[model samples]
Target: MSLPPAFLDELRARVPLAPVVGRRVKLTRAGREWKGCCPFHNEKTPSFYVNDDKGFYHCFGCGAHGDVIRFLTEQEGMGFIDAVKQLAAQAGMEVPSESPEARARAEVADTLQSLAGRAAEWFQAQLRSTAGAEARAYLDRRGVSATMIKDFALGFSPESRTALKTALKDAGEDKLVEAGLLGRSDDGQTYDRFRGRLMFPIRDRRGRVVGFGGRALGDIQPKYLNSADGPLFDKGRLLYNLDRAGPVAHKSGRLVVVEGYMDVIGVAQAGIAELVAPLGTAMTETQLALAWRQVDEPILCFDGDGAGQRAALRACLRALPLLAPGKSLRIATLPPGEDPDDLVKRGGAPAFEVVLDAALPLSEYLWRSETEGQDTATPERRAAVRQRLKAHADAIADPSVRALYAADFNARFDALYFARPERPPRQAFVRGARYVAPLAGASPALRSRGPGARTASGEVTALLAGLLTHPGLADRHGEALAALPMSDPRQAELRDAILSALALSPDLESDALNADLVRRGVGGLADATLKSNRLRFSFTRRDAAADATARDFGMMVDTIAARTRIELELETATARFRSSLEDSDFERQQALLAERVEIDSAMMRLAESLRDD
Candidate 1:
């Protein structure tokens, strides 16, 4: 039985090519495509490739090529119908039977799509006619070039209600109403849904016109209006410009989501092709999924205004439950009272590029949204913030990703709110009676025991050792460990090797990690660091309890990071004091000295705590 073309297309989109082909061929990722040895013909070197983005596989060795359907039929020797049935089942789609009713429904859907296309053409003709002067002038005011207008299929609907109906009269009234071109009132009176408005044709991924979005040229309520849901279009399931943006986003590994049609068009006019927009609504899960399929983290560019910020937060909340490893969003805030169209129009793509460059990852954006402008000065307020952050992190469906997010949020919270030790009263300074240098008179034992005694390199070595003993810590502290400053090339190489191994196999145990590191030529470094007497912390012990090891490892990382910051501050203050010799510089140096002392005491306390455990 013949299936609808739409159903077949949906099947291709739903079932990724990699897994389907991987069942028979061992595919390894090569750029955006997967490479595997051709199952059809055997050779030493691999030449078969499958591209999920294009939903096809090709073998350069034997010149074999086809999509998932063809692969199943040719490789598995399944009949065409059986191959399609298997894919349909895999995609969780019911195969359309070739019954008269189903055929009629399919025919109606096709007719509606065709009518929508013809309606688009009619609107374009109207935009070029004398009745479209207002729409043309509005486009000019928005700095939309003629080329852009044509490229995006920008058009207009005349002010009269019957203009489109009369233009496409042969399509009949019922089909026009069904296609969302005309609205029927309770009294059974039908009228044009869009009048005196700028028109945007919303197309499916196949570039078929599915619906229309209208921006009122004059003073109209609900400045933008989208077609009501119909068989051909569901706004929640579609993103504007997705048909064009998918291939570009896949190629560049960058996808951008804006707020509306003009934003997409404006950004595209600036030479960026990987852009899409929700049809006048907050992004839906399906829409976000579509964007994720194109790129792992699509940038959601929103205006910096309060409404824009709220929209962005809503999108974040919607996305939290759907986030998985490497699948999340980055948010870029436009200048207040500005959008992509405004920014691009005023300063071109370079201006938009700056915003994109400063985009915040999902975790950072969530933290800021929950804490920015809120009072976290008190313990109660801070506890509330923690609870809220935990709740959001808990929404993530993937356990490993959720745990990592929670750990990351905890680290950020400590850094921002709890890192600073309470300052001593100003009276304790005695107006800087005499500024003593930091740690100058400490005993050698105290100096050697303090976090300040270890260079950044030594601390990194100890951190790596702890990680090697407890490779599971990589799930929670991988990002932090990766960010640790390493000056020694050998230490950095070992650090990268450890992280790479963990990434390749997140559940790798200590022995497996050691083996993998050795394979990468850094096993000696790992062994030497572990065997050295320097890392005496309990967390580095093989027999340490999991909870204690994780806690102690976190403390070690925090202490090292704090020491690095204070050392940098001390160096800057010393440089300024040497140059100016001013009392303020001296006072600043002394204050930093106090902070440094406090950090050393904290480190000693941590050592004591770990030893007690």
Candidate 2:
């Protein structure tokens, strides 16, 4: 018995050919086609090619050529009818018997395709008529050139209920309704489904018009209207403009997926011909599979706004389960408040090209989406970040990919939390009026200035600025700073006052730290220090500045403490040498001389380190 031609076509379209042949053959992607050894004959080198895009398999060595049905019969050693039955069962299609009802239905399907083509032509004629003048003006205002209008086959539908019904009266009411071009009321009244709107013809892969999508000219609810699914149009199975973009994508090795029809047209007008858009919905798996068939990685161009970001996240989640070794997506976000159409019109094609060139890979986009705007300052928040990352990584179906994601996230966490700089040891020293004189080799003016000199003053200023810009540094290093000896009496008083305030209140950010300093009555000093050295320690990114300050502040504190210890030792050694004398005190004098030499060496090293800092 012969099966219905429609059933066979649907089976072939639904079942991808690569997986069917890959059951026995170890096929690998070679450019746009999958290559494997010919199953019919033994051969070491692979010359057999299977192309899902073209829906055929060809062997270069043996010159074997056929469709999916032919492959099943020949490879599996099954008869033609048996192969059809098995493939039909796998595709969830019922094989047809020689019955009158089935034949009538198949004929109806053919008639619907014919009617849909005629309806598209009728809409095109309406667009040229006087009734479509408003639609023409709207297109002109959008900067759509006449050539694009013709190429995209844009049209218009009139508001009259009977215009389409009257145009295709020869096809009868039931046929037009079956074609999804007209709707029927309960009382037997038939009206146009799409009226007074700009029309876009939706075509199948073979470039045949299967349905229409209409955009309203005025404030209509549901800004766009698409044809209801029927015999020819399966919304999920076909992408808009695929018939045109397929060849361009094959040549360019890239495919750009956008949100709407106009975006597709605008991008193509900007000289990028390899692009497609979904049919008035979020991208489906079938659409992604179609894109992957053309190119391994398609660039998804979304808006930079909140809604667009949400769409991108949704796409990433859906694609995780379907990901293979070399197949994925790249995401390009347009500038804020701009879509592809808006961007091209304002800055020309190069602006859109810039966004495409900087597209983020799937892994990078996923990481940023999960971690953006999250603060890891507190333990609770840091744990929350890790959990969120794990949840996303675990969703990936591929085990190896999940492992890689886990390792990357853990490394990033360590950099943020565990990787800390070493703190040099602080030595004991005498507290002498909270003052230490500058180096002896200094100029007379510098020596006379004492602690108030610009060099020393600048050091204190920078330290205070670091604490102010990254107040969390204060929380982490407050205990050390409170116990360390100070060289300036004013700075010592300020430190004690601020530390006392911070002891009472924790989680004080930069602004709160400033407020606490103000309450301590040392606000003026803090203000002056920040104002003078704004260039040296200005606030930029909080996270980056905090990391740098955490290292620099510790080093500065240790340097100061080291210098103080060396000076105190020098004083003690000089006193001992003067007090001890004669043969009986010879050993004490020699001990004093050794102590003086050690102090001088330490002082030199500290001075050099300070100069380097």
What candidate 2 gets wrong by more than 4 Å, as runs, is 1-106, 186-188, 420-613
TM-scores of the models, in the given order?
Answer: 0.58, 0.54
Best by TM-score: 1
Tell me how candidate 2 scores on lDDT.
0.72
Over the stretch 188-296, how does candidate 2's per-residue lDDT look in tens digits? 8899999999999998655768898999999887899988877767788788998788656754678899888899888788788888888877788888888887778
Worst 10 residues of 1 by lDDT: 438-447
Candidate 1 TM-score over all chains jointly: 0.58
Q: Per-residue alpha-carbon lDDT of model 1 for 575-609, expressed as tens digits? A: 44443346876787789878988998887787677
